[model samples]
Target: MPTLEDEIRRLMADETARLHAAPDLAERVMRSSRSKRRRVRVAALATSVAVIAAAPIGYLTVGSVAMTGQEPTISVVPEPPPIDDTPPVPTEPPNLGDLGDGREFGHVRVGYLPERLQWSQRSVDNGDRYSITYNYKGDDKGSYRVQIHMYEEEAVQEVDDQIQAYRGEEDGEGVTVGARSGYLVVQNVGEDGMKGTPTLFLRMGDRQWAEIMFSPVYAEEFSSAEAVDAELKRIGEGLTSTM
Candidate 1:
């Protein structure tokens, strides 16, 4: 029958066949490895893209302020000033010359006067003008003369010589006196020339102007002419314009 050599060879052949793997086993392992590699590469690429996209925002927020203890400053705004609304016009007093003493006159004064009148005399011409007069106290026969001229110029459209008999009229009533616009002239100058007076003109700004005369014939003080035109309009409304 078969010997020892043939028996040993057969046993070896059976063991080898039992230990062999299927042909596709190695190929499957390789494919799996390649898929894993591809997945890893894709993940890494996505991570890189995300980091790149966030770089600008991170730098602006953190790097800008953190690096220099002082963040970027953006401030700007300013625009205002323009409102006038209009409504303001009445100003004209400044020509402060002659000061005053008995009845004041730097702008004006003599608020009411009458007591046999007597502030005597004064004249001052060049220092812008003045006149003052007043007389009647203890009369002697000169009756009255309450003059007062003060003028830094302005109300005179000529008509001087005792108001030239109220020149062609028109500038005679409309009195507000003491602060502006006044007129009430009356002139006659008859006792052989300077005898009937009665002036009163006003306007004290825009270069000043005032004249408040009243001469009832050398001092015959009121009697008629409507009581000397009601005491020359009550001394031209009690004058008083220190401007």
Candidate 2:
């Protein structure tokens, strides 16, 4: 049997050993737990950081792609309308003479002449007649000349023959003059080697004739064969008796 003080000492030693072992075991467990926790925290932080960075990048990339795919719109402008401010001009009928009266015998178109001719009066068959003479200043001043005559006639054939002689053509040939019963007279009497046609208008009683002579040459300058025929027809359409 052991003494009392010795037993007490042995019990105290065993108790101290147990205390030290308990502390070491607790320290080991705490260290393992702390390491595991630290690993989990690190993994979570890395995942969160990756998610935050990729989110902004993905958003910006999508926005850029969408903007790039869109097309720009354009605006169109319209043109203005045109304005008309001019007045309308008056026009006359082709058949009617410029005088516009139905009573006139005929009309004469006088062009720009270097000089005007003097009018002379005479008696033909106890009826008054008019003569007009002018100097044609042209290159062939001597060969080309102009004369106009008006007379009362018992018949128009004689005056027609005279006009034919003047025009250097036989009467009742080349071209006819006037409308209805008028006279066609062509003359080639110019000092300038010029030729012209002077048409004559006659009254119904075979007692009146109006003559018009052109210078330079009617066939070559003042009037063409076709134009003379047309003018004569128009004059005859407006013919009236002056006797």
Please write out the lDDT profile of model 2 over residues 1-243, one tens digit for every residue: 997645655665576587755534444555786688666666655554555466522221111112222322322234456688888889532322232221221222223222332222211122345433344334342332333345555545566567556556445343333334455555445677555455544434455565544444533543466665565455444445555
Q: Model 2: what TM-score?
A: 0.32
Each prediction's total of clashing residue pairs, residues at least 3 apart in sequence or on different chains, is 9, 14
> TM-score for each prediction?
0.23, 0.32
Tens digits of per-residue lDDT for model 1, 1-243: 676545544554565467675544444555786688666666655555555566543222222222222333322233356689998999634433444445775557877776667665444444566556667666653334677777665334432433444545553565674345666666565667655666766655566666777765633546666676667667767766686
User: Could you tell me which residue pairs clash in candidate 1?
Assistant: 142-218, 142-219, 143-218, 143-219, 143-220, 144-218, 144-219, 189-193, 189-195
Top model number, TM-score: 2
Cα lDDT of candidate 1 equals 0.58
Give the lowest summed-lDDT range of ten residues in model 2.
58-67
